[model samples]
Target: MTLNPLSTPLCVVQATISQHGERAQLVGLSMPSAPFGTLPWQLIGLANYIVGCQTSDTAPSPETFTAHMQARATSAIPSPATLYPYTPWHDGRVRLLLDVTLGPAKVLKWPQASLVIMEQESGSGSCDWVRLSRERTAERILTRTVWEIEAEAQLLAGRLREAPDPSTSSLLEVAQKAARWARESRKAARAALTISQAARARHALRMR
Candidate 1:
């Protein structure tokens, strides 16, 4: 069955600033992608790992989404993650189920894809257990963050590209440069935070 785009799962992976000064809420989604379908709890497990717990149905950060949308040229999309359900038919395939909502209100409206995961029997095979592959989680988070960075970077670059289209004053040029710099700097700052946090972790580990 095709998923209603109005309510696809939004796996919110709460990124606590990585060891690389990077921060991103890696989202794992299990809508109808094209082939993967069926994994709901598994998706929850991963969500639990990243976004804490699957509490009240959370809505998209409109402000955040809006801002990102404004920078459209190279938007990396709000694609969180893909998950599917482990159906009997999906013996050797991985499956995931998600609760996704579209639009600002997420009023349940869109053509949600029910894609299937590659291969079968790929999951930890937990019924209700929240399977969190630390390695997979870390990998997904890192890759997701990089994707976001690239998207934002492209947006910033696009803005710069257009700055000269309307004849920006020297001051405007300076300001635009500063704006671009700030966006990149924020990303850098996040990396720094990650490094700082990691150093502390290592120190604590050594103390132990």
Candidate 2:
């Protein structure tokens, strides 16, 4: 019997931000071996260690970090501060997004798997990751951003709208609405980026 993707156990993916001075690069970690139904605290600790190790050579030793993470895990109730809702993957796996930020670092690495990092850009599809599976070679992952996702959704909505089937009209309407919302969100995000850049420029002038 085939199981519903929604009913599958949760798999957490870390969408980390590696900050270098004033710039931020988005990083995604592909953990094919990530155990299903992993706890939030455990994932958080793992993410911290991964980010720490990648971001700096001076990062705390694995033993030290593990001890600290363990202490936090047992002492407090883990909150969804960095966690996002579940998104079902095409492969029938559900993914939970964990947002994390790492400070300035000169180098980044993941010994076990490849690390794909992309600098944020202005246009859609500029900072997104696309993972592809190949039968002959290792899995390949690329960067993707929210803007690209919205753009793709809008394009898909357009195609659905043009479909010849009459029964799809209702579905098309829903898709169009979602596409509109995504477009608005993209606009707001761009505006926010503009404001942030302006603020940084002003600060730079003040410092000078």
Candidate 3:
């Protein structure tokens, strides 16, 4: 089932979760160069959070995950997973509102899990529900996930330990902690991505 029911440049995807079998699945996603033209990395974080949970055996409680996500953006430790600089409240509103509705639901059938990625295209009065094939979705998620991890790693490496001017020592200390958190998040995200998927992600990295 589509979420928005309107046309859009950014593709929409749907994944169904079952009580058994694979947990969270990357249903489908499309990161178009239009609306996301300025912040494609945000897409990677979105993909990881969603797919990573789907693939995991033990999913985080919606509230816990939501808070875990919020702290990343609001705290001194800003995560690449956050939309801090780009959107107000760092997209927390979307997470708080839509995500809770995504979990297992009997209405979707006995299997009890389903989700849809919906986005509003700029200038388009109506929201869109894009369609992407399974292969396309997996490819996008894997590629984006790898790119985000590497980009963040590079950012942390460059700033994490930079010696601050004497006057800025206090700021540096805060940065250090934030960097550590970002590093940990990256490590966890990498680990959460299954071994085969990680391999594919790396290959995708190499190809680019």
The numbered model that scores best in TM-score is: 2
Model 1 per-residue lDDT tens digits across residues 147-186: 4344544554576577754432433443344345334433
- Worst ten-residue run, lDDT, model 1? 105-114
**lDDT for position 138 in model 3:** 32
Candidate 1 TM-score to native = 0.23
- Give all candidates' CA lDDT scores: 0.32, 0.36, 0.36
Span of 10 residues, lowest total lDDT, candidate 2: 134-143
lDDT of 1 at 151: 51
Q: Give stretches of model 1 more than 4 Å off.
A: 1-29, 35-140, 144-208
lDDT of 1 at 149: 41
Cα lDDT tens digits for candidate 2, 1-70: 1223344433333333333344444433222223322332233334445434543444333333334443
What does each candidate score in C-alpha RMSD? 15.5, 14.9, 13.0
Off by over 4 Å in 2: 1-163
Candidate 3 lDDT over 84-153, as tens digits, reads: 2222112211221111123432211111222323333334346523322221233334454455445554
lDDT of 1 at 16: 15
